[model samples]
Target: MNNLFDLHLQIGSRRARQHIQDTPLWQLKQFTRKKKVPDLSSLEKFERSRKRFERKDRLLAIASLSRFAKLDIGREKRKGLPEVILAEGKLATDVAKITQAMLKRTGRAVVSRLTGSQVKAVRSIIGKEAKIEYFSRSRMMVVKSHSYTPRQSGGRVGILTAGTSDIPVAEEAEVIAREMGCETRSFFDVGVAGIHRLFEPVRDLLKWEADVILVVAGREGALPTVVAGIVDVPVIGVPTSRSYGFGERGLSALAAMLQSCSLGMAVVNIDGGVGAGAVAALVANRVGEYRTRVA
Candidate 1:
């Protein structure tokens, strides 16, 4: 009986050694090493997840004002231009709400094409939270926090209107450019009808070192082409709906600008004052940034 028991014990020990040899070295060593603390692994995973979430949040940095609107709060950070609210079709209450939310996020709100009711609603809703400036001619409104001051980009923009009727569009561009921190100099009623009226303003803009020029015109829209030919800087053409008879409502103006022969001229859609201004501001700001870096 004792011999049998010894043999059985030897057999069991042999089987255990065989199992150890069959196992991977890493698996065998794991048993001898201290067991990994689950807490550390979990913490590392949590940190990785947190970083991923932060990246996604930054990419989708938008503010939802209920379900009516989602304001692009990250616009200014991503593209040097702030998000502008168009109040043309939206309800006054909605516009006011969006303006409030935008002000809360960026401390500045620009609303374009605001009707009288929309302006009233915004002023009433915003109350003491911000100072609102209404441009009656352009039907636009600018809201700013009391402590906010626009940082100058040291960029200059020159704006010209073909006629008195085009002043509203030019004013809209002026407001947008100025809000973007560019100093704007405007000359009104400088159309090709009085071809000589264009030279003095062009000379003045050149003297002022204007980085970009915006020409707001209607009817034939020949002003931008003329300005582009004379000026070395970039010229953006903004056509307006200020014509009568054949090719009325700025169709002719848009066509004329698109078919311009000038080399340095770019054309925007009919009455696209906001787009023109934003583009002009972008160019001016780039020049300003370059100047800053070199200086």
Candidate 2:
């Protein structure tokens, strides 16, 4: 019956073989007994099995912080990414507490949109116990336990900014990508206004053999479209809150990107460096795994 259910998943005979190898007989019996039927359809059995695994994964690791926040320490295991702390509107002390809690469980925490005071507070909390890297341009900070090491892998990310002002967001993306163990190459001040300014960096990125690219833009947000047209890799557009007056704070930029005609282009939220960075890293990680298998 278990083999039949696995066949219903259509994941191939190799995966079915893995299922039998990895799952204990007692555990499989427990799953089968729950349905309370000697005979059952494969779909019904699979649904029950899927839900059981989902619930187990979801409840695996949780840390409580004074009834205010419950940190999902199992997020990295379940989602292939760690849970990050957002410090944009939170008090400095609160951010520190959350970071400390996360570090206690996961050995690492990323805090985004951190103010200068928040950085000081977080450093004070961890003291000499951990390492804290802060980027003033991006307003992002990474806290890692003393035992942490960069788990380097196979793919590369190319980050580009349309203007100097967009560098902060690009920097944020770079820091996150590096932390996630993806090699990153950056290109700056290459907007559509000076089309020629982009050519050299695009060539350089190709030379570096980037697996994915992210383009950060503010005013018109056409950089990603242009990049997607040129690069064979996937392109992610980051719309920064960098303009004023008529369009006002990246509204026009966001809209323009959402409507981009380019085939392989996607857009993130206004000043959403963390989101873009995380997504790019995930793609790079998957590509790296594929390369490793093929090699």
Candidate 3:
């Protein structure tokens, strides 16, 4: 049933028509096979028919290291998305082994989280074979970018930041959106303190014709609400952990965004720019697809 639609044109006329009829009995037998079964065992008959329903999708490989790494080999076909590695709570050596394993299987590459010190360990492992980049604010190092060559798509997404202090989170958003095939634009460092500085870029972004806006901010996090009032499209607030003396940098921002007075606004977690970017891309794709269908 997994590939039923595609199989319609592939199978023999008689065999295919028979399959449509046999599926009901197979399903009924399967339902009673595990239960009381009325009298004799229906399981033996169900097992024979179950063989016809095997899934046709690619199997994901789980790589073992200090922790578990699940590689989604079918992401390209199923979701039109690339695979990413979340590098957290693991040692440098551990990540190195996992990355090497994934590279061997997919030759596609892997992204993992690492600190500056851990990058040295990873450098020793992969050397020049991999193209690695470090995100300073996210405290993460990524090892893969060859997975997808992003193409242009409609409904541009604007990545905005409160100030230079929020660059780390903004970078994560940029990385994610690029991989998702969205035509993206970014502007940073225009918070509410000097409200005048924001008007110019905000005006320019409207001209750019964005479908959604991701506002990355820390501290008081009043930027997203103000941005919502100005923009006509969806405004996603990203609260970053870029503060101190106030629930570690992110706590205050999170609380402020959650309690915002704006309507039709959404917020992602502290420094969760990747998730926010992916969500924005999904919305952009939907908008584009709907327009296409209308046209």
Candidate 4:
């Protein structure tokens, strides 16, 4: 029995050797050879490449200022919408810091809803370093470095206000659209109360070949619906806080716009001029880009 067991073991050993011989030499070498560790110079080169990539990433990364804000520095590159600083609630000093940082990084900065004090702070901080265009009615400011140039997308935006009270909101939208490189034509004091006033402006917008229209209204907010019905291009309805009583603070206007019976009309939040303008600019820019490509 011992002799038989020894012969079986020898036969198994011979089969194992035959299988090893039949295996590919490369496969055998993979198991037999040790992986070569990278040399010091190669490791240094890889580290340098990694650091270079990290540097570039940092340039495009969100700029964090202590704990208060994380400025999206790469918004324009990523979304085609420039980052707009809303200075309504922030401290003036903080706004100034953010504006300076944004200007340094992007060569341009847009600030919306700026209080008088905030405006002063920003001007004091960045006045000598950049060119600041402040629109008092809209409470918006555009800051540009000396080397900065506004991009022209060959897009046109037509803006209309239902009433004079709604002009401030409409102005905000116009500023945003212009900053996005769209040519804007705006008309004010055309409300549903005086329906006839809208016809000429609507006709002019059509003749000017507007890519999109922003209609700003308050109270019952019927003007956007009217404009939407008349215009062939896209229409964005912006409700303002110019009403009173039960639907005060733009609630009624918001509701009316949301419930608009007009086709091809969209509504933003009450007093959301920034969002309205950004969306309109996006649509116009895309249209313009397509026109350019086709032409």
| Candidate that would win on lDDT | 1
lDDT of 2 at 51: 67
Task: Please identify model 4 stretches exceeding 4 Å from their true place.
Answer: 1-60
Question: Candidate 1: deviation at residue 73, Å?
Answer: 0.5
What lDDT is obtained when candidate 3 is compared to the true structure? 0.71
For model 2, give the 10-residue run with minimal summed lDDT.
2-11
Give lDDT tens digits, candidate 1, residues 1-295.
2232233235347654345334444443344344432233433443455567656776688988888899999887777888999999999999999999999889999999999999999999999888999999999899999988897897789999999999989988999999999999999998999999999999999999899999999998899999999999999999999998899999999999999999999999999999999999999999988888899
Per-prediction TM-score to the true structure, in the order listed: 0.81, 0.81, 0.71, 0.80
Q: How much lDDT does candidate 1 score?
A: 0.86
Candidate 4's displacement at residue 107, Å, is 0.5
Off by over 4 Å in 1: 1-57
* Steric clashes per prediction: 0, 0, 2, 0
Kindly list the per-residue Cα lDDT of model 3 for residues 170-288, writing each as its tens digit.
87777777666677888889999988889988888889877788999998888999999888989999998888885776998898888888887899998888788888887887786
Candidate 2 lDDT score relative to the true structure: 0.85
Candidate 2, residue 151: Cα displacement in angstroms equals 1.9
CA-lDDT, candidates in order:
0.86, 0.85, 0.71, 0.85
Error of 2 at 43 (Å): 24
Supply the TM-score for candidate 4. Answer: 0.80
The list of candidate 3 runs beyond 4 A from truth reads 1-68, 75-80, 104-107, 110-112, 136-148, 246-248, 289-295
Q: What are the C-alpha RMSDs, in order, of all predicted structures?
A: 14.0, 8.1, 9.5, 14.4
Q: Candidate 4, residue 89: CA error in Å?
A: 1.1
